[model samples]
Target: MAGYGRSDEEWGQLTSVGLAFLVERARLEKTTTYTELDATLRRRTGLRGFDFDQDSERAAMGHLLGLIVERNRPTTNLLISALVQYLNTNDAGPGFYALAVELGMLPRRSSATAKQAFWIGQLNALYAFYSAGRRGA
Candidate 1:
């Protein structure tokens, strides 16, 4: 779709139906917490719950990826770490905040536009790198 972190065939790799439902459900329920979204995903997909208590951000992301297995959602901590590396390499953004909320690291309903701006800035910077990577060897 017309948004950040989107691709022409984003639908190409994602478990379209499942991820769509999960994203929609999270939005509908006003559920900003990662745990809530995970629970919803598990319930909908009949999958196991993530172990956030263990500081497993990677595992948490994997659970989401596992649910959205059709697309490249990322399946390990390495992906999350890579994303973090990319983010800090420049700055962060709304997408990053959404990710933080989805990971239960940050909550939804942010009042701090400054924080959102910071996150958005970070995202734009990373996008530039990824875009460049796509055009090169």
Candidate 2:
């Protein structure tokens, strides 16, 4: 939202596109890589500002994801970004844990196993919430 200098409408558009993609992934019980998600956002929103190589762009993406999580947290009670991860590692970046800590979903001094368990729980919860009665649909 900051430093990108995009209008509110543009942010809304990006959020809409990203959230829909993530929701669909949740429904399918699938995880998407950051690169794939970036491509989808670019394709859907025509926004080319999501390059993961740049630290600023990556932070912006994390901000976008944080927005999505904040917007949906009340209704879903889940961190949707758990479904998005690095392709090589099939795991989220450190920002994920930082966000969790910021959101009070995880402790600041948690162990690696605890962080992993929290992320897995969030993913499972998202899959269950989004896929409810729609797995075969």
**What TM-score against the true fold does each predicted structure earn?**
0.34, 0.91
**lDDT (Cα, tens digit) per residue for candidate 2, span 1-137:** 54566677777888888888888899889999888988998888887757778887888888888887777777787788899898878577788899899888899999999999998998898888887645321
Residue 112 miss distance in model 2 (angstroms): 0.7
lDDT of 1 at 21: 45
User: lDDT at 87 for candidate 2?
Assistant: 84
- Cα displacement (angstroms), candidate 1, residue 123, comes to 13
Please state the error at residue 132 of candidate 1 in Å: 34
In model 1, the runs with Cα more than 4 Å from the true position are: 1-18, 25-31, 57-59, 62-114, 118-137
Output the lDDT of residue 52, model 2.
Answer: 72
In TM-score terms, candidate 1 sits at: 0.34
Candidate 1 RMSD computed on C-alpha atoms after optimal superposition onto the true structure: 13.8
